[model samples]
Target: MKKQPIHKIHIFGSVGSGKTTMAKNLSKVTGIPCYEIDNAVWIRNPSVDIRRTDQEIERNLQSIVQTNSWIIEGVHTKDWVNQSWQHADIIVFLNTSYFTRTLRIIKRFIKQKLGFEKANYQPTFRLFLNMFKWNKQFEKVDKVRFLQMTEMYEEKLIIINNRQDLNNWINNL
Candidate 1:
């Protein structure tokens, strides 16, 4: 059966590719519960670098699967995430340019500095450096790996390459 992903949507992309924003808007549009995977995986400083225990992560993900509807967004593409690809009805890959991602990261930093967004409690300089590292590594590895890994998978895999006419862009999919 050709399934429609009105329920489980897994959105992945390079940093600052607007996965969170897409999830938020899609959730509003579809009325499906959206879980920011980062929120589940991270607990912030003084708590633990990776928040969930193996069991905890499994349980959390299991609950989402059991619900039969979810939208997970983040950069962590573990083996388990590949398994997530199997069940996902829609897999959205935001293949944005490095320059765009870089600009978005800086803008987000400005938002944090201006008290518009909560500083996820990560140090500014280290986070900035980490983003640079990710930006470089992402362009070189992630997309190629994603294409290879998902070559045979059956899902509505979308590549949002450009930001122009987003609605038209998405509608084409």
Candidate 2:
């Protein structure tokens, strides 16, 4: 079968669910620019992270979606981000395992602390702990909420739980 042309992809998941990785890889292969929703939410500075106004975020996202093709990924699922989903040709929800996300969280923290990984913000212990909290909240609350929100887009939504399945789906794409 001929592959469908994907103009826009929205990928959302918990902190360590590989959303960024998937977006980057997809962008590389498809020649689409990958965007981080976090960048839309915050103006990153070495000393401080400033939050963007809701209007600013909306305008930023509007510009991206107006482009021909893009791959936007992040954990944001609020109303402000609903426009991205509305414009997406595909929506990927990574329902990664709790145990796996936990492992990735620890590994990411260590790598950031060791300067092996580049982080958008200072990787402090508080933020490291928050990753765990966010992950749990995502599993307990956001996961269900996301499912409910995306039900209207069922035909375009894809839920991935493991690396193998993700790889297969990517290969097929």
Candidate 3:
């Protein structure tokens, strides 16, 4: 099957749910730039560890908004993030299993620390555990919210519960 061309894509899901990985892959396949929300939201407080700040995050997101074409992926999709949906041609909601995503998060942490993931820096276990929060709370609730969000907008929305289905869409959609 011929893959449907994607112009501007937005990937949103629970943490450790492969939002970044899948976004990067889609960007490569479709030739779109992939933007990480972490770059916008995090600041290095050398005195302490790197912490995410709201001001820095808003600024970073504004910079990305200035761009022409890109794929932005994150777990935060509140009103502040409506800008992404405003410009995106396709919005993907990854609903991968909690257990699978948890494993991915753990492996991602190890890989990032070991230089296999090539993250800007390593994240702590607290940050990693936040995935559970997203899975059990935010994403769980947002799953219902996104349906309502889609009703208010006229764009392509894709929801995937498993990786195989997502992979099929990757090649077929």
Residue-by-residue lDDT tens digits, candidate 2, 46-102: 987999999999999999988989999988878878898999999999888999999
- CA lDDT scores, all candidates in order: 0.75, 0.91, 0.74
Clashing pairs in 3: 4-173
Model 1: per-residue lDDT, tens digit, 1-173?
67344677788888888888898888887788888766666665654366777566666666676677888887766655665677777788888788999999898888887888875565376777788888788889987777777776744677777776456756854
Question: Which 10-residue window in model 1 sums to the lowest lDDT?
Answer: 39-48
- TM-score per candidate, chains pooled: 0.85, 0.96, 0.78
The candidate, 1 or 3, that scores higher on TM-score is 1
Pick by TM-score: which candidate is best?
2
Which segments of candidate 1 are over 4 A away from where they belong?
1-5, 45-48, 51-55, 119-123
Least accurate 10 contiguous residues by lDDT in model 2? 163-172
Ranking by TM-score: 2, 1, 3
**Model 1 TM-score on a 0 to 1 scale:** 0.85
